[model samples]
Target: MLQNNSELKSKIDQLWNKFWSGGISNPLTAIEQITYLLFMKRLDELDQKRKADAEWTGENYTSKFEGQWIPPEYRNQSEPEKFAIDKRTLRWSEFKRMQAEEMLQHVQGKVFPFLKDLNGAESNFTHHMKNAVFIIPKAALLVEAVKTIDDIFAVMEKDSQEKGQAFQDIQGDVYEFLLSEIATAGKNGQFRTPRHIIKLMADLVQPQLGHRIADPACGTGGFLLGAYQYIITELAKKAGAKDLAPDEDGFIRTSVAASLTEKAQAILQQSLYGYDIDATMVRLGLMNLMMHGIDEPNIDYQDTLSKSYSEESAYDVVLANPPFTGSIDKGDINEALQLSTTKTELLFVENIYRLLKKGGTACVIVPQGVLFSSGKAFKDLRQILVERCDLKAIITLPSGVFKPYAGVSTAILLFTKVWGAKDKITKPATENVWFYEMVADGYSLDDKRNKQQGYGDLQDIINQYHARDAATDTDRTAKYFMVPRSEIADEKNNFDLSLSRYKTDVFEEVHYDAPDVILDRLIQAEVGNLDEAELAKLQSGIVRDLLDLKGMLG
Candidate 1:
């Protein structure tokens, strides 16, 4: 969505430059700091709107800024009331009116502390905010940032009204744009999954309302947010709302406000959960969900692969693009994960399998190597998917799908747990496995990833996957086909799930002259057997080419 709006894109670029020029060079740190400012602004605006709503309905409403608040650091003073400041003064709307120096001091000394404690001690956002620091170094820089953010919001509001897009969605896109500036990869091969790819996985998984959804290595909660948006869009369609439109990636989209009923709001508060080893990611992810109207996101700072994480078989839907880090410390590996290898890609897939409840579904992205590797662990993982679970589909993505961050060929695994069986397969659940080789993903395959004219195979993948028929989709020569489990599980195949293993390539037929005829033609040319007129024409052509070259050089 932000891609189509050059104005918004420019504004985001300007904001990024402001942060960089204003002493914040690290992309992650700059984004986190920017998130805090946005939250502060959004908090005040939302509170004001709620107040107006309460007054309109003649209801009792308590605003977050309704009373005086004491900074936690000053609470132990003998005369604590002397240190108290009016909560109203700490709001973005109020502080933004101050002089640059005063505003900087107010935000650093008073407003940030208030925001950190805004959700109270029990909230996960607050838990993650404990170590967060207000690090904008100068007053002029703070003033410029606030002005740029205001301009951005104004443009977002205008875009929302003019284009019938959601303001919240645009705001979310702004954050996503900010995140795209983090050019460097994180520890353990972690990087943000492209939002469109996440949307594709969400559609295949079809996370339902009230279904506990999770991402074990959710960097910035893209998968969880994708599922949430999908659920909201589905709800809007069910409600018969007519404002729904397809996003840039061709997925149906609607304003969260369209179907955000009280029940959905309540159910959503508990539905999406995520974990990441990076605390910064956890914080940014929580804020990301909150920015999109999820009041209390469950992203936290814990490595799911660690032995300490004990929640197994707890989620109903798992959508993840776990880091492709090759290996993890063997000692830190979770015991419940039955995979014996320390290969992070394999172990995380197993961890996802364990995280799903009986009959639960998981859509995960893994490097293509995991599909056809000859290693025993790779074969064993594929065996569990085919024999113990209802292995649904394997979609091979082009290697360039992750360009600029990685060029590793990857595939999506869509499967469901069956009867909660473990260790041994009581019965083989997969009769056939669906495979699709996606050649393009609606963007140029280069590092820039410029948007192309049409979405290539994205809409087709969704439509075909939902309408896939095992009986009729048997053409091995087509882009999509079904492969029998027996073929995949055969000893010769070694449980290889690579799409190429079953796909048949059809080469076009060509006719050529017999070898003797071609050889005679070659000899005729080499031996100068042509007529005098033909030889004269060839000599003239060579002379003309030489003249042209000499003329160009001169």
Candidate 2:
């Protein structure tokens, strides 16, 4: 979402070069230095406005936190505009009046709290302020470091094209880097969702205004962000307004601005909830929400599985690409969400069920193997979902969805918690699983693609999904087919959610050589007719395959 943020980039790079050259000994020191620069910029922008307005003490608290504090000798300045990185010795001499911890305590309790009290603002800066270290007294390079960063953000503009942050776009690399830096124990396989796929999935789920959305695993909050964009996009389109880019704020029409402002206000007050096991993810989630201009996100740092969530059918929409963790420690899940079983996806499925309100909808990304992974666990899950919720659709995504890095053959599994299902629609439960197979799903399993070529061409599959009624098992041209509920029941309640089971093979037209042409070939050079026994065997095989198709259609 960055645009014209070149200042941020150049300044950040400059700061990095300076810090690396100085040979800062600790990783914490690097993060602290960068954070300190961000803190100061934020502080100056906020306080200057208050001071100009004479809002503090009725007498203007004119710029106490700005670059004015650094001594000129320690400052990095030009002839006109001046700023400085306070020298190490000078910083110690001036700041030695307090201990390192006390400096941090003062910043948190006094300086940071002043910014926290601004009107029309609600921030937990005080909370995260605990992690905002002021180790200048010990890591004295830290004070000298703030100037290099001031130079960085001062010059480089942030790139808007990069998906998550202005820094990286290698798909999930944002979450990957964050996990390495902040939360290495980011629960097995809990990486971020791919961006394009997130957008596609959100479009299909179609969460609307006033609907509550939740992602229990909530890795770096990709789904929540996607859903937010989706809803906002639809709302904007409905209001006949442009989907203004973040960088295009100056182009906002009065009508669009008013609508977006109202919608933004509504969301902060009413919708959006998320939880994660990792505190670091929770912080990232909050930052993400804040960057997207959502205030007061109800994102808590808690283990949804470990906590008892009793409010069954509470949310309107649920979207998750949960960690494909295979099994869990017996003690991990709370008694409510804890099944007698251990498979992570299965537990999450049940957890989603409990979280949804009646008639609520949910879309989940799951390992394709789950569809047919034979087990008492899978069978029970299939039975519960088909019976309790209207199992609507299953999209078999290509195996390379997470490729080159993590190649997992995944599928989009969807369900709706409704008043009830038509218990006996004269079909088996196993047959009821509408399996849609995209040709893209069978593409090269190598976990990488040419970025120019794009990945997973599933628009046709999505077309068929939206064409719920027009779709059928008879039209072999389409990528999807459905079995009757009775048929699904026949799989002995094994709702594998695999597409291959439901989609009939599309037989391309084969042109056979004419009899005269064959005779001409024989006359010109060639071969004899097949013997009776061989031809009979071929005929038998054809007959058997026809019967298989016939049965698959039913």
Candidate 3:
């Protein structure tokens, strides 16, 4: 959507350049600072909206900004001597109108502390807000950033209204676009998944409202948000709302609040969760979910593959594109994961399996080498998927899916945990595994990833997945088909899951001219000075001979 608004992008780019020029060069930190400002603005707007609604409806409503405040200098003084400042002055709407220097000082002195204390000590925002620092360094930079953000939000409001999208939906898009900027800024191993691919995975998983969903390596919480949006859209449709409408890039924008009952919304909010190793990413993920209307997203800073994480068999649906190019220390790896290596990819895959409850399902992305690598850890992980769970689908993605950061080929592994009575791991329920080779994902595979029309396979993959039949999908030459588990278990295959391993290429036979005919044509053309017509005929004969040879080779 940002691609459709060049002016909006130019404003954002100017904002980023201002940050770099203002001394905050770290992309992650820049994003965090921007997030704080956006949060401040949204908080004031939310309070204002609630207050107006309460006045109109004659309902008792408490505003977050309606409270007394203590000045910093008087806080340590005796109660009688201490002076108080109105909390209303700390509101973003009020402080943003102050002079540049005064505004910077007030935000650092009062507003940030207020943000830290928001909700309560137990809220996710409060927990992550503990270490938040405003380091813009210059009031001019802050003022410029604030103005740019105001413009950004204004454009977002107009765009959302014109497109019949919720403000929160546009907010999510804005956050995603910012995240993509971070990815392009060269944050190592932190590329956010393309929105279209996230939607495709969400559709394949078809997460329900009550289902518990999680992402272990949730960079910016894209997959978790995708699942949340899908669930919301389905709920809306069930409530007689129109089917989700796609935007220019094929993303469906829907209002979750319009469809679900209060109780259902509360449950939906708690049903989504995420975990990440990076503290900065955890903060971003939480903010990303919060901006999209999730009041209390369960995102935390925890290495799911490390011993510090202990929530086994907890989630119902696990969706992730875990980091593939790193490995953890052997001693720090969780004891619950039985993999023999410290490879983060393998451990994260196994960790996802462990995190699933009985009958739980997961759709995860892994490097392509995981499909056919002869490494013991690789083969062992595949064995577990094939023998212990219902291996549903192996969708191979193009190598450039994570372009500019990583061109490593990857695939989505969809499987369900099978536990017998007493939660014992049982034999797999898999009979056949569906394989889909995605050559394009609606965007060019290049680093730019510009949108392209009629080149993506995501929707077709989703549609064919629901209608797939092992009996009818027997054409190995096609992009979508099923391969029986027996064939996958063949000794020569070594449990290879790559589509190329099972797919049969159709080669056509051809015939060619004899070598003598080609040699004679060449000699005739090069021999004595012949008439122009004779030479022309000989040239034509030589071309025919070459064509015949090429056809035979084909």
Candidate 4:
């Protein structure tokens, strides 16, 4: 829906520029401030919707806004003073009607504290909200932002109704578009993966309900959210719902709450998890999942590749695009990772492998260097994947996939852990590894990343992966093919997983005119106005030059 909503995009742009001009120049900070405002507005909207539903169905539902306020300063005061101020005034609906200055004071003084105390003192939201500050700085900017957000939501509501889309889907799109703005600003080493690529990875993994899905270096929780949406869509299909329709961006938006039973929804909420080193990213990731109906998102602020994290073999499915350009402190590296390297990319890959339970699958993106680097650390890691696990597929992505932020070529590695009994080393279970060369991902490979119709290979890659046949499908020249493990283990290849190493070029031959015939044609074309004697002289001179050149060569 965001693809077709020009007005919405304009409004968001206006809001972003307002923040920039209003002295909030940092993109992440600006986005956080906007997120807090949007959350406030959405909280009131959701409460009202629930109240109406409860009234219609005669169900008992308590609204979070239906309470009284006793400020910490007045808690020990007289009863009259303690009960004097109504907590309802802190609600967005009530305060939005007040004067701009009054609204700002009320939100900064009361509403933010109220949010920090939501769910309980132990809730993740409250824990993260403890450090949240309202930095809008002026009543006028806050008012303008609130108005623009209202208009944005209005457009989203209309689009959702017309397209049968979940409102959360539209909200997620709005958040993603905002994040893409961050990518466009040239924030090095910190960029959200495109949604279509996330969806493709989710489909390849095929996550199901009750499966613990995690992203160790989740940026805004895109991959985990994709897996959540995929599971919900599959549940809908199984329940006989209509086909999930694709939006203009080619993403299928489905209402998980409407399609899934309460139990299934609970399982889904508990199954999704994420971690990020940046506290701001953790907060945004939490808000991202919570806005999508995951009541309690399990996202935390922790460097997952550090020694402090000990959650090995705890997740059933691991999906991540971890930071690929940094190295960790040698003292901070986890002892559990046997790979000898501080490269975050290689260490994160090993960490992902360690985090998976036996038989658990993982789909991760890494730099192209990880596939075929001749370094001992790189080759050792590749051997661990090829010999110790069921290394499934190697998908080489274009260098421009993360363009404008990083042009480092990347690839997706799909494998499953297979630990032997008694901790003995196990033989490689991989007979053949599927390889896919993704030339286009539905978008141009430039900084603009404009969508190109009928050019993306995502769906075709997914299809060929599922229908892959090792015995009969032996064309190495095709985009999709398989290579045997024995060939991968050959000393000459050094277990190189790059597709180009195994792919063979098919040469086509062409015929050309003889040199004498070509020279005769050229002479005829140039000697049209020359006399016979002149033409003969020209031919004799050409022959004499040719003879001299041939003698010199000899």
Candidates 2 and 4 compared: the better one by TM-score is: 4
lDDT of each: 0.86, 0.56, 0.82, 0.83
Best by lDDT: 1
For residues 224-251, what per-residue lDDT tens digits would candidate 4 score against the true structure?
8899988888888888887577755565
Extract clashing residue pairs from model 1: none
| Residue pairs with clashing backbones, model 3 | none
Q: Best-fitting candidate, measured by TM-score?
A: 1
Model 4 alpha-carbon drift over 4 Å, by segment: 69-87, 183-188, 249-251, 420-422, 510-554
**Model 4: which residue pairs collide?**
none
Model 1 lDDT tens row, 58-137: 97989999788987777788999988889889878889999999999989988998888888878888899999999999
The per-prediction CA RMSD against the true structure, in angstroms, equals 5.2, 12.8, 5.1, 5.2
Model 2 lDDT tens row, 264-289: 65763467888777655565665555
Q: Candidate 3: global Cα-lDDT?
A: 0.82
TM-scores of the candidates in the order shown: 0.91, 0.64, 0.88, 0.89
Name the weakest run of 10 consecutive residues (lDDT summed) in model 3. 419-428
Cα distance off (Å), candidate 3, residue 506: 2.3
Candidate achieving higher TM-score, 2 or 3: 3
